[model samples]
Target: MNIRNLAATFVIALFGFFTLNLGLDYGLRNTVPHVLQRRLLNRVTADVVAIGNSVIASGFDVAAFDRASGMHSINAGLGAAEFAQQYVAWKLVTNERTDIKQVVFGTFDYSVTNTKPTKWTTWHSNNALPFYADPSWSIRYGCASRADEVVYLLARRVPLFTERGGLWTKVETLRRYLGGVGFPAAQINRFGRISDSKLLLEQNTEVFERLGRSIVETRVPLVDPVADLLKEAQQKGIASFMVLMPLPADRRSFYAMPGWKAYVVYLRELLSQTGTRLIEATEWSDSREDFADFVHLSEIGAAKFSTRLSEAMQCAK
Candidate 1:
């Protein structure tokens, strides 16, 4: 082809790409779960907000907690979240309303010690938090760098440049449905993607022990993102508390490990410094029946835990 024809084709292709990218980006911005979450955050009035990962996503029954505590509550838990995402959720809620008097963070050993930002990992787009997160807040919390900010801005304009976890999650759901066409339906919780449900079974005794040891031995700095989150909550006059949610029966054995106990002691000291309270509820429910899988609580379990959590807060006060 002549240079004139090639140039014309290139321009047309680029235009098509931009058109498609922007179209998808617009649709995604309106359709994702964060749109609904943002709407809720705007109007949500609560005395307490629960923030964390899948554990709290499935474990914190807002209705039960409200009923038990005699105070309104909202669960802003995000699946696949760490402190970075939790901090963003905190910012979103606090920025929108002044009713939040207490912030309850649900955690496990792995999450409590994880200082890295979610944007640095493959799970960045595991949920719609990235789409809703403020670019400046992300950088302020060390969740995203300047390069990441550029990419985030590009994603806002052209979502095709962003991670495709949401689309891939849908594709994976379809694949799982096709594969399980004739089998008994798997009991899955609503907190995370169906594709990730099997992850619970993979965390065996050995894996739990190793993870515990790593968490205990990891040299975390005195003030990391988790502490930063607690400190920020305190600065806003919102009391912060971390609840160590209960695990499955056998998995709770790790709590008895020497390293695990030491980690808890260290964690309590850290929380004390930040004016955050640490609630140890790991042994609250020893029944394997309470868990949906390995770590997340079932509906029944959530109701029980939420009530107990309310009482614990009352007692602490």
Candidate 2:
């Protein structure tokens, strides 16, 4: 073909491909986010909706808490979520369920920041697209950079080149495929998602904690966006509280880099300034045995904390 014809064909194909990408992103139902959207969109009126990162996502057992508290609840925790995504979750839950009398936000050192790859990973868009159709969500929930979007589409969705996660998870996936079985039970429900698995006995907590600390400290800090949301909820007469969820006592000292210590101090000041009710992880002291990881509570831990949270709500009431 002549150069002109070849270039024209290339342009047409590119446009078609881009259109297809858009269609797939919006049209197809997202696996994880859809669950959350359905939970919120359902006509159920929950008294407490816990929104945070993975800490509470899989950590809090909403059903157990509901049984204990005698109040409806839901856990809207996203894995690897930072403040921006959690705030969106908060908005989503409250907006959909006006009967939400209280909101329990799971706050950590980095819960107020966007340094996490919410945009690049399409975590935000995955949740927002189902209910929030605004074009702005493309930037808010997706990679703002067109170049990055191209890369994500190529890497994540393209069949031959999907992200396989860590080496162990890869091995686990292969094991399941080869062995005609599945990974150990991953229980997800409208209440929440929690793996029944326990944290590995010899897991290298220190190294992972250090790496997490390093990445967080290098990013520019953000103001406590949750504070504003809480303030609004309070104004609307929606009771609200914060949970200063830190790593387990054993690993906290090792994990809290200098910057993290400073961030905690700042967080405390912010809470004091706003008069936000708080449930610090240290207060209850979840046993090290109850953790599935450095912070996420296991099922037994979830049972314990869910009861504690229920009792706390009783006191609040």
- Candidate number with greatest TM-score: 1
Flag clash pairs in model 2. Answer: none
Q: Which ten residues in a row have the lowest lDDT in candidate 1?
A: 117-126
For model 1 the TM-score comes to 0.85
Score every model by TM-score.
0.85, 0.63
Assess the local accuracy of residue 72 in candidate 2 as a C-alpha lDDT between 0 and 100: 84
- Give each model's whole-structure lDDT: 0.72, 0.59
Candidate 1: tens digits of C-alpha lDDT, residues 43-82:
5568998988788888999999999999998888877765
Root-mean-square deviation of each candidate, in angstroms? 3.2, 7.3
Candidate 1: give its CA RMSD in angstroms. Answer: 3.2
| The best candidate in terms of lDDT | 1
